[model samples]
Target: MTTPLATSSSVFLQGLALSLGLIVAIGAQNAFVLRQGLRREHVGSVVLFCAMADALLISAGVLGMAQALGERPSLARFLALAGAAFLLLYGWQALWRARHSNQLEASAGGNGISRRSALAQAAAFTLLNPHVYLDTVLLVGSIGAQQAAALRGWFVAGASAASLCWFVALGFGARWLAPWFARPRAWQVLDGLIGVTMLVLSALLLRHALTGL
Candidate 1:
């Protein structure tokens, strides 16, 4: 028979592994976080906001919000379309930055963006993406709910821990790349890559939204 400690450890590890699998992907949110990290502007606030938002969503999912959301197809579609539109705009902005690559530079000091603006962008990136909902709410939540009642809390804790660790690493670890991004050409390439990724994600999301209609 499995001891309580063993069962708890198993559940927590499952949550950590699953969450990491879902989150450690190249998406608009990751791109934005990476950019902010490279820019060294309000990285703490951005990371904190993203991690906290994820934790809230994960907790909600475990608490049966997943079932509520699953019953609402219209809401999912709306979110997809909205996310696509937002991604398209952000993609355009990234592409514009790439085109004007001369202005791209790794700042050793502060970048001119305010904390409020940074937080706003972080919120938009976190909240606007339907994938975030699908992953945290539907996928993670459903799986978590399947666990023994006593262990659901442990699962959420593990998942929340993963988010916090990931955001902290990504937001702070990016400074190591500051040397490479010191060159304008590197920034140009990075922005161009981000632009293409955002646009492709937008297209896919838009297609998903329309197909469901």
Candidate 2:
């Protein structure tokens, strides 16, 4: 018979692995976190905020919120549409920066934004993206809820750990890439890529929402 400890370990590892797989992709949230990290502005708070948000969402999922969401199609559609609009606006802003910014230095220009602005942007990036809900609440939560009651907490802990570690690494490790972003053209390229990515994601979300309707 499988021991309780062993089973709990298995569940924890599964949660960790699954969460990492889902969030390792370069999406709007990750891109925003990476940018903050590169700028080295309020990195600690941003990372903490993201990690806490993920933890709360994952916990909600494990508590059966996923089922409630699944039964509410209208709510889901609204979220997708709203998220798409947010992404569209942010993408345009990124493209504008790419077009107008010339002398982009690693420790310069971008730092002018206040801490409140940084946190606000972080909040928007985290909350406005529907994919975050799909991944953390729906996918992860559903999976976690399926676990035995005794193991559910362990699973959530594992998933939360993954989020915390990933954000910490991404937010703090971004400085290493400071050298590459030092050049004006490099900033332009990075901004352009972020813009294209956001736009593509927004378009996809919008299409999904419309088709489902």
User: Which 10-residue span in candidate 1 carries the lowest summed lDDT?
Assistant: 101-110
* Pairs in clash, predicted candidate 1: none
lDDT of each: 0.75, 0.75
Query: Alpha-carbon error at 135 in model 2, in Å?
Result: 0.9
User: In the order shown, what is each candidate's alpha-carbon RMSD?
Assistant: 9.4, 9.3
| Candidate 2: tens digits of C-alpha lDDT, residues 97-211 | 7886554233334535778988898899989989889878876675565555678889999999989998998789877754544566776876677677667756866787788
Residue 65, candidate 2: C-alpha displacement in angstroms: 4.4
Worst 10 residues of 2 by lDDT: 103-112
